[model samples]
Target: ARATVRNARALAQALHDRGFDVLAADLGFTRSHTLAVRVEREGGGESVAQRLAAVGVIANKNLLPGDTSPKHPGGIRIGTPEVTRLGMGEREMVRVAEILDDLLHRGKPPEAVAAEVAELKAGFTTLRYCFAAGEAAYRYYDLVGRDPP
Candidate 1:
């Protein structure tokens, strides 16, 4: 829980520093494993979420003030549990923020960012904070199909 929240806060701060409208930033962004980025543009949440997915960075479309329907929202929620469990720390959050800013803010191609995302994932192949020390994260998922013990 501590690492999750810490990573979330770090990610939020980094995103915010990169000119993103991170929700509840004044209140330390959040105290949970998640943080929200409000993308109050024409396409908004769904659009941003899809773009991130194309770059191999997963995020969920979230409703915000301008959102009129669940299918179309104005925010994207990013969670930290998976990365945290993969032994990522605040430093990695900085790199994540760079990817987001490049893709979303600078209009970088998803293909270009996908390579960066894949490289980052490859660096953290083991699980931490859960499972036995030195356990393989992806293999554990493959063995269980879902849920972790």
Candidate 2:
């Protein structure tokens, strides 16, 4: 829980620095793992979410003020729970923001961004806040039937 809050705060700052209009900036960006971004100018929330997902940055389309339909909202909701569980910190958040900026503003290809995302993800395979520290979160199917290595 603590790591989630810390990483979420870092992500909010990174997103703000990369020119995304982060909501509730006056309230220190966010209190939980979720951060809301207004993406009405670049595209609607749904489109932006799809673009991000295509580049391996998963996010959800969300409704902001003046938005009535779920299909076409005005904001994108990003969260750090999974990454935090993977033990990412502020630096990773900044990297993620850069990836988003490249994909969203600089017109980078999704495959290119996905390469970077994969590299970043490779370093954090062990999950945190569950099991023993440093234990692998997922076990291989072949190994599952055997004794612990």
The TM-scores, one per candidate, come to 0.90, 0.87
Across 1-149, the per-residue lDDT of candidate 2 in tens digits comes to 87888888998999899898999999999999899999998698989998888767889999997888877899999999888887899899999999988888888888999999989988988877666657775555346675422
lDDT of each: 0.87, 0.86
Which segments of model 1 are wrong by more than 4 Å? 141-149
Off by over 4 Å in 2: 140-149
Question: Distance from true position, residue 68, model 1, in Å?
Answer: 2.4
lDDT of 1 by residue, 1-149 (tens): 89899999999999999999999978999989999889975258888888888878889999976678887788999999999998999999999999999888888878889988998888997878675757877675677687632
**What shift in Å separates residue 63 of candidate 2 from its native position after superposition?**
0.5
What is the TM-score (0 to 1) of candidate 1?
Answer: 0.90
Which candidate number would show the highest lDDT if scored against the true structure? 1
